[model samples]
Target: MIPSILPTYNRAPLSFVKGEGVWLQTEDGRRYLDLGAGIAVNALGHANPDLVDALTTQANALWHVSNLYQIPAQQKLADALVERTFADTCFFTNSGTEAMELVVKMARKYWHDQGQPERTRILTFEGAFHGRSSAAIAAVGTEKMTKGFGPLLSGFTQLPWGDHEALREAAAQADVGAILIEPVQGEGGIRPVPDQCLKGLRDLCDDIGALLIFDEVQCGMGRTGKLFAHEWAGVTPDIMMVAKGIGGGFPLGAVLATEAAAACMVAGTHGSTYGGNPLACAVGAKVMEIVASEDFLDGVRARSGRLRQGLEGLVASHPEVFEGVRGTGLMLGLKCKGAPADLVQAGYAEGVLTVPAADNVVRLLPPLNIAEAEIDEALSRLDRVAARVGSDAG
Candidate 1:
């Protein structure tokens, strides 16, 4: 292999030539069940006909248009998001990190606009993965990700995951402006904050008059059998960031907020060039149409049951490899007792693709539309990999 242009991202040896539905084909014509789904971006599956058509149709019409112009597709997608969720306004971005950056600005700017500029501190959780940008990294500035980044950004505080006492203390402080969290911690090994805990946080935020922000970059959309993960807790966030599944593999993200919370972002507040391009919005609109349907969401719940049950059965048979299973719906995780990366590699070799996340867990983010037979096939491959890895460890 030739040297790459960028040193970032440890490249996997296998290169996929084509993908359809929940399967990927390598250059050598070998097929593999793709449980990872491009880290949960391919919500409708790879090369989905509807998404492809939407993209191609829009590409022939218009590809790039500045935010200065009236983009109908952008408005349509935003309308869909608002109609389905608690947000009354929307801001588009090119990726989750950018959406998060906008969120940080919006949260702080809200307090600043209200004449309390000193209340700028944003509370984040330990082991949370926001993104790689300066502000996003600062929000999640633990030792692992912030070692090389000099002089972490100010006005961000960290607390242990699910620490109610710490959260209450921080919220009580006058400097704290908002609380940011992932309803289900995606990169932190699919650790889901309890539904009751989410409700408790909502109540706390309400009492403190602090905004509650949910980073739904990974666990939102249909992945959690709900339009948004917070819906399960019967709580709504003041501001939410969504990406990954919104574009159905296209680069798109959005910040959704209530009318009062979003009022601070007035004219000349923020902007993005390719944030709401017609091409991406066309595809995103289609994705929203499909994933937001009652039937589609119900199917996600049903499929989630089958997948979780299969994984639990796998764990029962191969306890040495997988200690437990966690997370909700299609965004499931296998807590690996052995080497998670090794297990991922073994699964790849056995014609299955899995993603390795933090906490020594392997994530399964198969397409929301994956069939029952494909689920069975993925389970069989996992069984083989688990047996092999377990035997070696034994």
Candidate 2:
């Protein structure tokens, strides 16, 4: 029997009624420390006052004005993004999936406008989760994501993860016009592509005349202690997808591109009706203003260091449960020696919420502005979860 809502998610039994900062209160009034931060969406913390104010202020003034007309809030967000990052232009969207769709179109259209329509293929890597859209699923080309969705969108080639030789060979192909990757793979278990590797990708793209696209939807907006994860590598993508924390919990996304890369996307090339609505852009502008500051990012780094050090200690003390830690900044993952789901269940018992990802990892993506005391409390709660996991194993 199908329920009123889709049963797509194996949702936890508990229902959260409200959230504040790094804590969520269940319907029954139990408080749980939110280490996942809604899968890295609530970067400033749940119900952030700044974001709330921005949204409400815009809601009172204006809400929806289609892209057919100019939107000041949208322009403001675009200007903020352009000022803070490598993008020369920005196209707003409602989610990362929409951003990915635009990224593909922009890349292929660039070649088409350049009189090379044959160069349509884009290369992606294993363990990559772009989005659930047909183009994104096909870009990843994973059986898990594409099993039932046949006759998938073509022109995307999937390469083995971390196989530089394969990547170089694929990108050098005449038909390959772009390479898409996640600077920090959030769904693929919080794997941070080494700085050197990102640099190499940039070099390879330059040599092959292929555009580089970064999916920063999960690791951007100060999650990696940088404005974006690719900043840590000191290399910029020709096209970048941003979402999740950009709106500090409000649904918003953008595809940012260099002028050269976006040249082909003329007036009618792309657009959206609800994209860049006043409400979303207003909130995103506030998030950008707060997160793109050096002071805030430095705090993120310091907190990340403390949290990473504590996680290292946790790994040492719980060898039976955890293998190691992976990732940078607040987007950390615990590589579990056992099933990561067990650790997640244990965390639930201890009132700490976490997210499980591929590669036997449990992700800890707490709010970027999480307090030092909250960090200590989170560590203590995680320790209890680890102890509980050890007990269950014994």
Candidate 3:
């Protein structure tokens, strides 16, 4: 029976009442350690004081104002984004899919303004997950995402994941205006494209005069300990999309681009009513302040090392459940031999929350600011889950 809320998710039986730091409380008062961190959205963790303050302060002052009017908070957030990243311009959105849509438009229009309207093709790879929107579905036409959506949007070409030769040939082709890819694929079993490969792709795009777009929507905002995942490769894209942690749990996303790449996006070309709403921008700005600090990022790196070591230990201890662990910083994945969903259920029973992903991988996206003690507690819960899984298999 379909409930009014839409049965899209195979949701766990648990219903959380409230959250604080890296913990979620059930209505009946059981506390669960939140390793998922709302799929990497809660960078500062649930009900963060700074973000709460930012939201409430803005709510007291103002709420919704159309982009037609000058919004200082929005501008402030844009300035912060531009100052920290490679983008010369910023466009706000309510979610990652919307930001992705804006980027697609910007890329096609940039070539159009240059009188090369035929160059509208975008290159993506296999095992990529963009978003759920139409354009996004077409951008990443995985069978699971495109089953019902027929006659998918055109102009997107899917390349084999990690095939450098194929990528080179495709990049050399005409009508290829832009190349869109994720440096660290969040939904593709936590696969990270090698650093040398990113450098090669960047060089190839530069040679072919194609705009490079990095969908850092899942890997940005300190999820990888760096400001963006591409920072590890030291390659910057002409355009980038960021969401998730940028809002610290509030819905906020942004499309960032170089001035030359965005030159064609003039007035009346595109706009969003609630894209840069003061409320979203206010919280986003505070999140930026906290995540952009070197001290905080350094701490994230430390925690990542700790988690990696602990997971490696788990793999050794419970070879029946896990094979290995992968991913950078807080965006980790435990490669499971058993069903990932079953492991997630085990975690639920042990008072820990984890997310299941493709390739039998269970993801751990703990908040960037999670405490050391919480990390130990989460590991303890995972150890218990491992024992349960092993016992059941036996």
Best by lDDT: 2
For each candidate in the order shown, give its overall lDDT on alpha carbons: 0.93, 0.93, 0.93
TM-score of each: 0.98, 0.99, 0.99
- Tens digits of per-residue lDDT, candidate 3, 1-394, equal 7799987887789989999999999999999999999998999999999899999999999999799799999999999999998889999999999999999999999999999999999999998988999999999988889998889989999999988888888887889999999988998889988999889889988899999999998899998889998989998999999998999999999999999999899999999999999999999999999999999999999999999899999999999999999999999999999899889999889999999889999999999999988999899999999999889888
In the range 1-394, model 1's lDDT, one tens digit per residue, is 6565766778788999999999999999999999999999999999999999999999999999799999999999999999999999999999999999999999999999999998899999987989999898899988878888979889899998878898888888999889999999989999999999999989988898899999999999899999898999999999999999999999999999999999999989999989999999999999999999999999999999999999999999997788899999999999998768989988877999999999999999999999999899899999999988987887
Q: Score candidate 2 by TM-score against the native.
A: 0.99
Q: Write the per-residue lDDT of candidate 2 for residues 1-394, one digit (tens) a residue.
A: 8999999789888889999999999888899999999999999999888889999999999988798889999999999999889999999999999999999999999999999999999999888888999999999988889998899999999999899888877877899999999999988999989999999999999998999999999999999999999998889999999999998999999999999999899988898999999999999999999999999999999999999999999999999989999999999999998898999988888899999999999999999999999999999999999999998998
Q: How does model 2 fare in lDDT? A: 0.93
Candidate 3 least-lDDT 10 residues: 1-10
Model 1: CA > 4 A from native: none
Better of 2 and 3 by lDDT: 2
